[model samples]
Target: MQKSLKDLKVYSSSDFPSYLPKLNALYDDLFSGGKGFRSKLIQMVSRHLSLKNEAVYLLAQTIEFIHNASLLHDDLVDRSSLRRNKTTAWLKYTPEYAVLAGDYLLARVMVNLSEFGNIRLIQYTAEMISDLLEGEWIQDSLVGEWNVTLEQLNQVHNLKTASLFKWCLRAPFVAQETYDEDIHQLLDEMGGLLGLLFQRSDDLLDFNVRNYEGKAILGDLKSGYMNSFAAFLLQDCEEALRLKFKKAQSLDEVKLLVTPDLFERRLQEFDQVNQESIDLYLHLMEQLAQALPEKEQGLRDDLIKLPHPLYWRKR
Candidate 1:
C-alpha cells in the first residue's frame, strides 16, 4: 500500500535519546524549517516497490540523518553564519555540541541499519558518506581558484550532491533485494544529471537570477568560491577581468565588471546548456520506464515531474 506523506515522519522526538543535554533542542532546530526533499524522494521511490511501511520510513530517515550530518560539518568548515534563514547549529550551540550531534546522527544510522539487518545497504551508505567527504575536500581546495572550470565543479557536485540522489533512487531497490545492474546504472546516471541541474540552478540564485528565495546575492563570489554559473560566465574572460571579478562585493559590482548585457547573455547560455541536460534526463526516464516492471511503470510519472521544477525553480 502506498503511504501518505502525513503518515511519514522522518524525524521524531522519541527517535533520539533524551538524556543527552541540549541534543533534542538542537535537533528540533536542525530538522525544522528545512526542505526535507531527500527524505521525500526516498518515500516517493519506496512507495512504488513492495516495501513495508517500516522499511520505507527507515530509508527516509537514514537519508535525512546523513544529509543533515553533512550540513552540520559543512557550516562549521565554511564558517557559515546561517542555514535555513536561522543561525547555524555551530553558532547557536557550541561548535563541540554541533560536531557531537552530527556524529551521533551518523552513529544512529548504522545502529538502525544493523538492526534492520541489510549488509548491502549499510555498506553502500558508508561508501556514499566517504564520497561526500572526498568531494568536500576537493571543493575546499578550489576556494580562491578563480580559473576553476565548470568541469571541475561538476566533479565535486557528482560526489557531494549526486551521491545522495543516487542513493535515493537506488537504495529502495537495494532494500527490496533487487540487484539488477542495468537498472541501477541507469538510475545512477539520472541522479547525476539531477544533481548537476539542481546545483547549477542554486548557483544561479547567487547571481539573483530567478532568485525567488531572495538568497543573499554574491555570497559565493564574496566567499572566494566560484560556483558553476560563475565558472561558465568567466570561462572566456581576460585575466584582468577575472581579477576584477574576484573582488566584487555586490551583485551590482559583479554586473559592472561583466557588463549587464553580457551577464544576461551568459545566464541565458548557462540555462541553455542545462536545458540540454534536462532533455537527456528525460530520455533516460524513457529507458528507465522500459526497464522497470509494468506495475512499477507509474514510478516514472512521479519522477518525470522532478527535473523541470528542480532546474527551473518553478513548481
Candidate 2:
C-alpha cells in the first residue's frame, strides 16, 4: 500500500547544508501542520496512470515544496500573522529567514528534479512556478480594487492556485514519458476547475462559512484584498449595498451590512451564479475517470470526495 500523505517524509537533514539552521527548522515547522492536499491530489492522479510509487513520492515532495514555498512568500506579502492556526513563518522566524527558506525549497526542487534526470519535468515545473509568481504579482496589484470582476479573479486563481493543480495532475504522466496530448489537456482542465473550486471554498471560509482547519476569518478583507466570494456576491447586489461595501474601510464596517440575514441571502445568490463551476468540476472528473486506460475507480472516488462538501454547505 502507498504511504499516507501524513507519513510521507519530505525533509531529511541530508537535503540541507549544515550552515543554514534557520531555513532547516523553518521547513520542519511549516511542513508539519499541512494536510498535504497537493500531494494527495498527485497521488490520486498517479494511481490512475499506474505509475511507480517511488516516482509519485518524488513528485509529491516536489509539488509540496512548491506549494509551501509559496505560502512562506505569501505570508510575507499578505503580512499574515497566523497559518495553520500557528504563527506564520515570516512572523515566527525572521522575515529574512522566511524569504530565504522559500528560496531554499525551490532550489531543492530543482536539484531533485535534475537528479531524477527528466528534462520535461524540469521544464514543466519551472513554468508552473513562474505562473504562481505571476499570479501573486497580479493579486498584489489588485489589492483594494474592490470592484474586481469575477473574470479578473478567475485569472488570478487560475495562475496562483490552479497552476499547481494543473502541474500535479499532469506531472505523473510527464515523469513516465507519456505524451498523450488529449489526456494532458483533460487533466489540465480538471486541475484548473479543481483549483478554482478549492480557492473559492477557501475564500468562503473568510465569511465563517466553514473552518476547515480553524483558518482566520475576514483576513482577506482586513488586508484590503477582496475575496472571490465577496466579489461574486457584490456583482448582483443592490446599489446601496454595493456602495456600502465599497466605502467601508475595515472588516467590522463590512460586517455591519453583511449581517446574518443579508449574508444568508447573498450566499444563496452566490451559489446560484457559480453553479456551473461546481457542475463542471464533477463533469471533468467523471470524464477523466472513464477516459483513462487503466481502471482505477478509486482515484476518481477519492477526487470526487474532496469537493463534495464545498458546494453548498454552510459549514
Candidate 3:
C-alpha cells in the first residue's frame, strides 16, 4: 500500500505543467516536507472499512492536495519564511505564484475526486474550501484578542482543521453508498475532537516544549498571536499563569516567561487537560468504528490505537 501510494505521489509530481518549472519545484518541495498524518489516518480508516482499491487513491489524493493547499495559504497568512526546515512556498516562490500553485492543487483534487462520480464528495469538498477560509478569517480576527474562549477556538479549528478530517471519513462512506447517519455524526465528533487535540499539540511545538525541534519556540507568543493551547491555558488558569501569559506581547516576552520550572509545570498541566480531551475523543472514535464495514475491524482497532504514545506525543 505504501509503495503504491508513493507511486501515485510520483505521478502527481510528474503531472506538473512542463513550462512552469518553478511551480513544479514548489509543489514537490511542500509535498515531500509534510508529516503525512492525515494521509496515514485516511488510509488506516479506509482499510478498517475495507474500502476497495480504486477508491483509496482518490481519497488519498484529495486529502494530500487539500492539505498542501492549506499549508501554502497558511504560510502566506503567517508570513512564515520557513516550513519543515525549508523556505515556505510564499517565501521560495513569489506570493502570487504560491497562491496560484495552491489553487492549482485544489483544482486537481476536484478533478481527481470526479473519478468517483460522487456528487456528495464533490459538494463536501466545496464546502470544506469555504470552511477553511472561514476558519482562517476567524482566527486572524482573534489574533490580538486576548479573551478568546475555548468554545470560539474549537469552532474555528472545526472549520479550518477539522472539516477536512470530517470529510476524510465521510467521503469514503458516501462513495460506498453506505452512509450511516449515526456513524457519520460520531466520526464528525471524533474528527472535531482530534483536530482540537492535534492543533493544541501543534501550538505546544511553538512553546519550545520538551526541547522540541522544528517549530520556532515562543514564535506565536512573540507574534502577539495566542494559539488555541494558550487560549485554553489562560482561561481560568491560576493567577500567576494568567499573568505570565498576559505579559507576553511578542517573542521576547514569551522567551522570558518560560523559565525551566515553569516549563515543567506548564507541560504537566497541559498533559492533564490534553489527555482528558484525547481520551474523550478516542471513545468517540471507537463508537464511530462500530459502523465500519465488517471486514475492516482491524482498521477500527488501529483507530483506537491511534495518536500513539498518547501523553508524550506532544512532548
Query: Per-residue lDDT for 170-233 in model 3, tens only?
Result: 7777767666789778877877767767777778777655435455676776666778767755
Candidate 2 residue pairs in clash (backbone atoms < 3 Å): none
Collision count for each candidate, in order: 0, 0, 3
Candidate 3 lands at a TM-score of: 0.86
RMSD over all Cα atoms, model 3 = 3.4
lDDT of each model, Cα atoms only?
Answer: 0.91, 0.82, 0.73
Ranking by lDDT: 1, 2, 3
What is the overall TM-score of model 1 with all chains considered together? 0.97
lDDT of 1 by residue, 257-304 (tens): 999999999998999999999999999999999999998998999999
Rank by TM-score, highest first. Answer: 1, 2, 3
Lowest summed lDDT over 10 consecutive residues: which window, candidate 2? 306-315
lDDT of 3: 0.73
State model 2's lDDT: 0.82
Candidate with more favorable, higher lDDT: 1 or 2:
1
